[model samples]
Target: MIGATGFIGLNVVDALQARGVSVRATWRKKSITVFAQKRNPEWCLAELDDTVALEEAMRGCDVVFFAGGHYPRYSLDRRASIERGRADVRAVCTAAMHADVPRVVYTSSIGTLDGSVAGPVNADDRTVDPPRESVYRATKWAMEEEVDFALARGLDVVTVLPGACLGPWDVRLGTTGVLVALLNGALPWWVDGIVNVADVRDVAAVHVAAAEVAPRGARYAFGGVTTTMRALFEDLARRWGVRFPPEELDVAAAYIRADVEEAAAAPRRGRVPMPRELVDLVAWGRRVDSSRAALELGVVARDRETTLEDARQWLERMGHVPRRAEATAVRSRNSAESTRGASAHAGSRKR
Candidate 1:
């Protein structure tokens, strides 16, 4: 499994290990010892561009999980991101083909599919004609194109397009960063939008299942639930008992705020306070369907409420939430629940 140290990739490794499958996981220069200590999978130190090393990693392996790709944050290096995205897929597919690997499971993003349509997005959905202007989206689209090219060259490949993934092992806090930012008080208001969300654990399970049972040249779009931004924050507020900001910003206001934040933070931090990509993402309000995955690959999603609770618990346990804040939140939640229970009992007696 390439990108074994990544958020999704590490979970994939864990899922494979849980099934008692021997996995040969890869790492770059900076090693992730947690992957070694916990899973004990054979580790390969290989860069994405190193075709020779990738070939070595693929040797003797019947299946390869190519979960490595560039998803830049804060900074927009369009040229470099596109180049690396294309190169990673090319190198992995080429190495897998040369190694005569029977199955290659590539992790793509839902961003490659069109989200502007009025209904739930599926694997067959295509991006808008001429494509939208976003470096990250373009990079993912390019990677998908690379997959198609590899398929034409007689390589058997399956693609898994996961939605905004949350849950544990988000060491980098990539997709879950919004929650962190809200908890940390960095974000003062919510953007009015909707997003398809999936737990990383579920996503990883789908990837492993796809590798095992999915038909070659198949593509699966999987996410747990579709929720509005307000609904998500409201859920968190209910669970945490915190008075989160109630203001909702329109897309225009959000873009303007992002621009202002970027201008102010760039000089000091060399990173934008909020990337334009994020603004565009929050402005995206599309539902996604993963029923095909469920019916075909047996991919099942945990309930959304349960998934959020797990995420909150993980964040608290990982020290991402301060002790004092957590205590306050707990007390507030208990008080609110107690009051609601009392009201319901009283109403029942009156009735």
Candidate 2:
């Protein structure tokens, strides 16, 4: 596994490990120490920018799983974000082809596909044309082109387009992290939008199965339930017994566009607005299909209930919810209040 320490990558590593596979994971040079602490002891150091090191990491590997792609944060400068993504695709593909890895499972995203599909069962959907949502989508599609070139050269490769992956082992990054934050009461209100989502473990399972069973040139969609922003947050809140802001802010796209532009002008500490050209993203909605993935790769998604329950369990385990602690604090406060009232009454009688 190339990116064994990332949000999705960590889940992939854990799933693979549980199945008795010893992962020879790799991370960027600077990430080696932190990744090493959490990953298998056999983890290797490879800089994505260093072609030679990347090639060495792929050596002797039967299948190379490229989960190393980074999604640009909303804060990145536009041009630099595009360049970084292009560089990643160039570097990783160049190294993999050179190392002659028999098969490479490249993790792309549902963003690369047209979001106009009617629902999650639209198995006939194809790729979208130019002028997309985010720089991340553009770069991911660009990487897909590299994989196409590799396929033309008779290299065995399969690509997976995963929807928003959410589950445990999240280091609190990615889109899933945003959901986590909302569940933890950080987000003020539900941003009105719809997204297809799947558990990280389910996505990882598809990747591993694709690596083992999928044929060359197969592209699979790894999406689970289709949901609106409102529905997802509501479900999560109910599961966790937490209260979320149900009040949807009535901001139109024009309002957001103007504000985002103003914000972009000032460029805060590490935050960047979505590209002004792509501000229509929140208004865009579509379902994805993973039937192909199911039929071909035998990937079965845990039902929506299971996924939500698992997410709640994960939050509890991570101490994101101090349920018992909150209860104890409330009891302590009540006790103190009772004692104060009794003492005040006794003093009044003495007076």
- Per-residue lDDT tens digits for candidate 1, residues 183-300, read 6656676576777889888999889889888898999998678888788878877766566765678888876776676566656653442455566666656788899899998888
TM-score top scorer:
1
Task: Rate residue 71 of model 1 by lDDT.
Answer: 67
Q: Estimate each model's TM-score.
A: 0.86, 0.81
Across 2-63, the per-residue lDDT of candidate 2 in tens digits comes to 77777677777777878888778887755534643565547677888888988898888888
Candidate 2's C-alpha lDDT? 0.69
The Cα RMSD in angstroms, rounded to one decimal, for candidate 2 relative to the true structure is 5.0
Clashes of each: 0, 2
> What's the CA RMSD for each of the models?
7.0, 5.0
